[model samples]
Target chain A: MAANQEEVKLLGVVGSPFVCRVRIALKFKGIEYEFLEENLANKSDLLLKYNPVHKKVPVFVHNEKPIAESLVIVEYIDETWNNNPILPSDPYQKALARFWSKFIDDKVVGAAWKSAFTVDEKERGKNVQEALEGLQFLEDEIKEKKFFGGEEIGLVDIAGVFIAFWIPIVQEIAGLQLFSSEKFPNLYKWSQELINHSVVKEVLPPREPLFAFFKGRYESLIASQ
Target chain B: MAANQEEVKLLGVVGSPFVCRVRIALKFKGIEYEFLEENLANKSDLLLKYNPVHKKVPVFVHNEKPIAESLVIVEYIDETWNNNPILPSDPYQKALARFWSKFIDDKVVGAAWKSAFTVDEKERGKNVQEALEGLQFLEDEIKEKKFFGGEEIGLVDIAGVFIAFWIPIVQEIAGLQLFSSEKFPNLYKWSQELINHSVVKEVLPPREPLFAFFKGRYESLIASQ
Candidate 1:
């Protein structure tokens, strides 16, 4: 059963994949949450007080206790809820899930940021190549699995929410091509399936609006450059 | 209650803080394992097979199943051994533990690397200041606690093995100082206590040899530059 909104609250900015991943976890566990929109330009005192170190968004506050860091929040959710488990049960499998998720965070998302977000043309080219190499690793890892977790969305699958949803949107506007069916069929299919997953699709921001925001942001960067 | 050497093996090189932390975790849980040395310059096929993704060391193999990543290995040890509980039981506290360790990895250790390892003199100064600022956060966080885990060495304390042992050695040889008794008194005290902890002390490489290794490595970088 879902908890009431008053007991469970989430503070985050819209369009953030970190926040998106957290929401997916909440919904997966049938946990009801009150989403408090945060303005990144002017960070709220609550956000700062809860997460003094990073001062970033996606703070999940349950009964006034805040949990920061998306992955940490997700793990906390799994640990606390203890239903529809997001991470594997076995020690070794759980370790692999953690390992692959870290790889995604450290390698794939990192390279994707440089490739599509940076204003430097040279850096874009370099990171484009880097992102492609990283995608190859994912392609091989995912293989023919429906998801990284095999027929379910779990830590690695949700950790890769960015690659599943954001990359294509950003790459198109930034005039880049990195992930595609031709290069990585299995990985691409899994990504497509992930975004379209019922739980994931419900919480995802409207595609067109999200795309427009990035489009404008990308153009603004280029215009300013 | 510990697994035997044939059933449990660790592949790594000496002087890697990642490997050192895993050793601390194993000792905490009383896991018996054989150590397999790897020549990083020419990585062994066994290491390659175990950790093809990162190709880094500290691969903990239990029952022929390999687990990569230092923190992941530590978690696996805690989960499998089910003794000397390294992480906090509460979900919120666990999240905080994860967050702080990441802060150590992303902020303090990152800055320390640039400060002491980089050839660029200007970069070193900037990163030296950065590292000191990071240490200030740690000092504040540690305030009056015996360990980050409080009353016992846990995930955060073990994760900070690099700061406790490696930083002092590297900074001295590299002609830099970011963490010390004067600047971060509380954190420095914790570091000293952690390094001297019986379990950690037994596994640590000798100071003289470790110092000499970094000194040679640092001088080589400067000589090449």
Candidate 2:
């Protein structure tokens, strides 16, 4: 069991891939934190206070300071605790990891989310195509290594996990497959290997509930469009 | 003068903000690395061989392994050499820095660049609005701190120099001033303080040529559109 750090807390909404990232990072570092579930429709005062600009969840409060953004939160967790470092010690390797992490954060998850939300078929297809290009880029980039950081779950792998976990939920909602075994064999295998980790599996909310939640959100968004 | 380390070499293009980031990181860390400039239009065989997929420059070659991405390269430099660690040892503070870094990297610089290049008045306005929003967010976030990392130039500050240096160049090329003292006072002041750093100033290419290059590119892009 991790230490009961009352000084440390995490504010997040359920079913958010971004929040899930922080959860996994905390667990990986064996850092205990209080989890405050936020409502997107009605954000908590703490959430608002912590991330006044974004007003989004996954805000890590430690010793009273609040940190927003999932990847940044994860990096914070790794750095603050001095536990299992998520990034490599080598500068070159770390840069490679950051590159892939940024790529996935921007292209795979970000673009896919946009595509799933867009109503116009043509616009949605363009988003999806760009999302696929991002995936292909991931596939090609990962060719040289087992994991993005090479044989271990680093910053790159954690960031990339958003695509793997959320893609399925998103696919079920969008009624279109973005990443297929045939199209991205390496990524497919790597994702399966990633989620199978005990830490990752433990931190992730039950997929069924997540699927339903995202599905409803996507449908409502599409309907509005 | 830094020692010759055959173990370290940087492959990049001249005048690239991304590549300049790596150069600054190396110089800051007092690490010796040979610089190899690339022609993005006609990429060198080495650039392709190092970063095969994107064929992008700013690939840091260390002990023969290539690492891509500017932010990642910064991390690599911090980790590889223990001197002048760019990130804080504390986990939460590190996350706060990473959060702003990501926010600025993905949003502020991104929107500003788009605003600069966009020909559509409506789209340009939208992009400029977004850029302002991003800057506002940064201004608010940095209110409590001296630097993005607080007190000293750290990872977040380095990651965010994109706005400091490149935005000025973009403003010059686009003939639109989005960041003014009246508009974004803190960011404007922050930019002034940042660019004044010898490392930052030295690493960044002169504005005149960069502006000319981007002006040509933007004009060509608008012409095509």
Candidate 3:
């Protein structure tokens, strides 16, 4: 690859777990990429043009080609440069891993993230309960299997790290407990294990920073009412 | 590839768009597998064990290595066999395609489908609006490309097909208009093109049967309360 063509750039905001997903994937693969922090409040012209549809951050640009959506970007990185493969070789096991990953991608952050803004106690409780149900499903389904795919950290593990790392912080920020360590022992243990992973550990923001940002954001969202 | 290791079998309920995703993938790849119809109300033990987690149908057992989740199964089929590839060779294009697929898979089905069941007109309207927004996004993003990845029916096309084929029937069943052909001419036209594909047409259920079944089920759901 030519020098200019070899560049891999990521446009994202700080304190975004979605952006973290792409960051982790790139780090794990040992791929060098320039990171540009976008102030989501005032997105760049390039960001708008590259991703006009959703216009969200964490856009991975590889050799000038832009790929929006974190998981999609991660998959693109994995496919383009095959270093540390995040997916398994066996087709069956790979499918099982993708299944759980998609489940997490679709449900945990997708729905559970909404619990922060709910005003009604009953409605909030329902949302929290639904989120817990998804967590329980993970706990029950991921017994004995080391990382939701059997003894290896793959795409599912990457998707789930959001819940394992960010959810507790989110819970702290929102003053809610969706995953009780006792109720979801397996999930709790898994979270701890994931936190210990070197790649995950390396990329994680300091707790104080994440907590401060999230707590302030939550407070603002509530106070705006 | 041994005969005695239990032939590849798919346990699925008829008329499930999720199941259809797996079916089209299998047929597209020209892979011969046994199709077992599962009665969801009284699910068989095999189906339960095959998909012990979700306990849902559309379980693909390849040499008894059971894999659940429709998109996962489709990807597995595409990877395991190599007759007709579904995803594109270009990594960027593939990522773009998967992003759209995941977007449609997670958003369109959840928000729009849930909207079909709500009692309040306001909530239902939100659902309709969300569905239309998703379709419009597809129209705008899918730039003059024959398929989502440029040409041929890829994963994005597959993802769209699930709702694409059933939305019209669902509208008729729910006595509402969520997917107006006028609003999403490109998507509507794409849906027609998808079903008309020889491979897709072969695997898809007859429109009337699926229409009747899904319509009846939704009606029953609304009537129960």
Candidate 4:
């Protein structure tokens, strides 16, 4: 690392898969950065000041310039570091990559996770079924490719960090099984490949602690109901 | 246009600001393509085949490849064409452009429009207040720049096509004058400039029909409550 390299800083919360995406991207590019853990319960002034609009982590600040939105931040990392490109160079292929990434964020993580956390028992079942249907779409998408990027863990793979790591914890907490080998073999295999990747392995939180945290939340949610 | 150029097509609905984003992008790049109007009431097989996941409009097809999501499609168009760039070339600037574009889409259009369309009178006031706060943030962002892209109408401007053209009609339909010149002077001025731009003017549906269409819907909404 050169002394003149722009100082890169990441403000993030633990167990946030969005933050993990940035961490993986930074490691893949082998860029050094200072990581500031933000207590989302009581957000720090730095986090508030930098990302006032969303006021959420992870906010990636490079040389004092703040960029919010995890996917947008990952693209910034790819653009800044020339080696080991994450997005495709071709216009059409790049569009495809971005399309999938947005699908994962919008449908898979956003909609699926909300459905998994539903308080009503009957609605929970219905929501979970819909979420799985969405996952099935992704499973079909990755049928032949080694990764969503085809040969490497690229934008789509990074966007799916939650599915690879956090979904199991969510499933355990909610006492539901969403991913099955027979039902979504490709997605299951892809999750294993993603979690085992050296860069990903370093950023993922330990499962036991994550399980305990979410378990308490789920219990409280059920009790409140 | 070259005879050998891939057959480009857009799947869209009339009065959809999202579909308008794609239309403006195509015209800006001088790309010739067929526009297939999808009866959203009864969607076509082509729309379902190309964008089964979202089952929504503004799907851009180049050759045989289909791309969904308006911002993604706009970026694709910018990348494919070498001239009249929509996104900034520099990585940091490009990231900034994307950030604002997403902000407008997610916060401004998403929240503001929902508030403006609120049925209950009391909740409508509260929602409108929150929506105005979001618009205030955007107003501050564009305080110095002629457009969010600084000098040119770029990706952010394209992403905010709704605010430029659709919102005034929404105001008329909902009977809510949210974009007061005194409150959001900069944004008001920008909206005028954007609507009057040659490329934007070419695609904007005439105001009278748009108003009549939204008025009928608003009447049904109010009557239902």
User: In model 1, how large is the Cα lDDT of residue A158?
Assistant: 91
Cα-based lDDT at residue A136, candidate 4 = 91
Native-referenced DockQ of model 2: 0.64
**Which scores better on lDDT, 1 or 2?**
1
Q: Tell me the tens digit of each residue's lDDT in model 2 across B128-199.
A: 999988888888766756567666778877877788888888887788888877887777777787788777
lDDT of 2 at B114: 86
Could you estimate the TM-score for every candidate? 0.97, 0.88, 0.89, 0.95
Candidate 1, residues A67-101, lDDT tens digits: the string is 88899899999998988999999888899899889
Best by TM-score: 1
True contacts kept of 1: 0.97
- Stretches off by above 4 angstroms in model 2 are A83-85, A88-93, A137-154, A221-225, B141-152, B221-225
Q: Could you tell me the TM-score of candidate 1?
A: 0.97
* Residue A39 CA displacement from its true place in model 2, Å: 0.7
Point out where model 1 deviates above 4 Å.
none
Candidate 3 chain A lowest-lDDT run of ten = A144-153
- TM-score of predicted structure 4: 0.95
lDDT by candidate, in order shown = 0.89, 0.79, 0.79, 0.87
After superposing candidate 4 on the true structure, give the runs of residues whose Cα lies further than 4 Å from its correct spot: A1-4, B1-4, B121-126
DockQ of each: 0.88, 0.64, 0.72, 0.87
